[model samples]
Target: MSTFTLDELVRVLRESAGEEEGVDLEGDILDVPFDDLGYDSLALLNTVIGIQQAVGVTLPDDIVSQELTPRLLLDLVNGHIARPAAGKA
Candidate 1:
């Protein structure tokens, strides 16, 4: 399983949105959704894809379908790590 951190996710998210300043995401960003952060689904999808590739987590293409919070993303990745689908690495 890959060791992807929430902090790294936040960094990638910020960078993906071309936001380098004034995006205070220091504390519990786990509960914050992408829309609340003023980001669209594309940004969230990009972030999810980046994290999936970085961590090798087998995430579905529509991972942003649900709430799409940091905690949800982490949980999904952890679930995939625990039990990957058959015939899938």
Candidate 2:
């Protein structure tokens, strides 16, 4: 099974869109809202795309809006990664 960690998310976020000024992604940001982290909708959307490319997962279109925090996003992605495809089992 594939696993997506907070560190990976930070890396993908930086790769997709450079970190905002004065924001420390290395700190405890799991619960912090994306807005508080200086990330807008567009930035998050790009990060989602990056995650998709990096993890080979097809996330839902509404994921960006649905998962506001990093922890939430991690949960959603990991859940998707752990689930088996339809008709396989």
Candidate 3:
């Protein structure tokens, strides 16, 4: 299982926000909400899919409903990595 890093979360979130060229996110972004970062539920779902692929974990689609924030994402991914599923999604 691959433990997620804050930096990785930033990059994935930035990409998930639809920055095709990608943005160099820095500083305190963990505290920022996904909506503030320009993402809605649909976009956040996309981001969650990206996280699933990147981290090789089976994540529930409703995770975005829990709150689409960097901090929440980081914590969730860490939890998944710490306890990976027997079968991946």
Candidate 4:
């Protein structure tokens, strides 16, 4: 399974946020508040969809309401994305 480290996650977030290159994705992502990440609610939803597309997994329903910090997001994504699908019981 593919796993996104905090660094890769920050890079994707930076791109999704429309940040310019040469900017520090980690520092910038950590510093900016989620509301000021340059994306609106819909845009944030789109970003979530994009992550699902790239990672081949769907996040939980409450993802948007939670995970306001980079570290929290990393944990959520890592934990959920790595979880096994419900089947084969």
Candidate 5:
């Protein structure tokens, strides 16, 4: 299983929704809220879609609304990736 790293998240975020001016995504932003990073719910939703496409994971529909920070989101995505799909175990 491929681990979803912060770098990948940053890339998807930038691709789905352009970063805010003066906001450095390369910085330590794992705990930073998406709003503080100039990302609204819509941007996050788009990013979630992008991640699902890239990582081939079926995240929950409310994932974006639930995971507000990169760390939390990463944990959730990685958890999904680590677990086997239904009936596969």
Candidate 6:
């Protein structure tokens, strides 16, 4: 899998946060909290879906309950991307 850079991940988060147009995607997403991202649980679920769509990997459910931060999310994505394909054993 291709590595997803921090900037690209931040841009995706910003877009998911509904700030996609001209806003600076580099800004901190944790400026307030996940709620302010204008996303309800369903939207967040869809955001995870977006992540899957963009990166071709599924995020663990616990990641959200743990209060995903920008940095942590990037780390999680990086980890997923770095892992070998399933059933390669």
The best candidate in terms of lDDT: 5
lDDT of each: 0.71, 0.86, 0.73, 0.60, 0.87, 0.61
**Candidate 1 has which clashing residue pairs, if any?**
none
Would you list the clashing residue pairs of candidate 5? none
lDDT per residue (tens digit) for residues 57-89 in model 4: 777645664336656666667766677462111
Clashes by residue pair, model 3: none
Question: Which candidate comes out best when scored by TM-score?
Answer: 5
lDDT, candidate 5, at 83: 88
Query: Model 5, 1-89: lDDT tens per residue?
Result: 87999999999999999899999999999999898999989898899899989899888758776348999999888988988473133
lDDT of 3 by residue, 1-89 (tens): 55799878767766766642333357566767777666788888888888887887888876776346788888877887887762354
The ten-residue window of minimal lDDT in model 6 covers 30-39
Q: TM-score for every candidate vs. truth?
A: 0.76, 0.89, 0.77, 0.64, 0.89, 0.61
Question: lDDT value for candidate 2?
Answer: 0.86
Residue 84 of model 6 has an lDDT of 37
User: For every candidate structure, what is the RMSD over all alpha carbons to the true structure, in angstroms?
Assistant: 2.9, 3.0, 3.7, 4.2, 2.7, 4.3
**Model 4: colliding residue pairs:** none
Model 1 over residues 1-89: C-alpha lDDT tens digits? 55567777777777676453555677667888767766678877787777776767657777686467788877777777778782163
lDDT string, candidate 6, 1-45, tens digits:
678776776556555645534445456664434555445565556
As a TM-score, model 5 comes out at 0.89
Tens-place lDDT digits, model 2, residues 11-85: 999999889989999999999988889888899989989988988877875777734999999998887788735
Query: Can you tell me which runs of candidate 3 are displaced by over 4 Å?
Result: 20-24, 86-89
TM-score of candidate 4 to 2 decimals? 0.64
> Deviation in angstroms for 52 in model 3?
0.7
